[model samples]
Target: MPEPERKSKITASRKLLLKSLMLAKAKEEWDQEIVDKQAEKERYLSERVTPLHTSGLSLSQLQDLCRELHEKVEIVDEERYDIEAKCNHNTREERPVEVGDWRKNVEAMSGMEGRKKMFDAAKSPTGQ
Candidate 1:
């Protein structure tokens, strides 16, 4: 009825409409983002995942397949363990011999007189 009151009511209605539109826009954007993410996930799965070839197999057949695979994996793991153990044993057995040979070679190269000089130099305080 008065001019100021009508203007105030129109402003309030305009503010409410703007708020509702903003909320609707935000919800639409959020829904679009979720759809985009789902599509991306589906694309990634289609590209990266290898489909199993057990389509026609029964449950018993699948169980047998799984058991055979498990047995093969176990056999391969045991063989790997045996190989590793053999390598460790060989390394342990050879290390001492290799060190002894290296020391002998060094001694042979330096000779007794050189060793004596080195020992005297180490014993001396200034170590010239």
Candidate 2:
């Protein structure tokens, strides 16, 4: 009887199959990571306090809290106004008078007449 044909060992096909399987496994892991991140986000949102959290407070308690918050806001506004006024006053007082003098000096040195006067002064003898 003739011997049965032996299967040829093809390393290239085996390597390709392995690479495909590894890529599939990596894709599955990436999908799971995305799912986990979405679930975590949902959990965080659910855990946050909403407006309904104050539902347990009585109407009188809520009213009193509101009144207290209004008082605090008014006090803060007054303090902020005072601070702004002081800052404005300090800024006005801190301005240097020399800035105006410097500007005048710069203007004197800029024009053609100023350059002619400068040349004349330079040409004059030091003894004069």
Tell me, by TM-score, which candidate is best.
1
CA lDDT for candidate 1: 0.87
Backbone clash tally (model 2): 0
List, residue by residue over 1-128, the lDDT tens digit for candidate 2. 99999876778889899899999999999999999999999888878733334577899988987997799889999999999999999999988766456777778889988888888888899822
Scored by CA lDDT, what does every candidate get? Answer: 0.87, 0.86
Best by lDDT: 1
* RMSD, candidate 1, Å: 20.3
lDDT of 1 by residue, 25-119 (tens): 99999999999999999999999776768999999999998998799889999999999999999998877643356786677659888788888
Which residue pairs come into collision in candidate 1?
A: none
TM-score per candidate: 0.39, 0.35
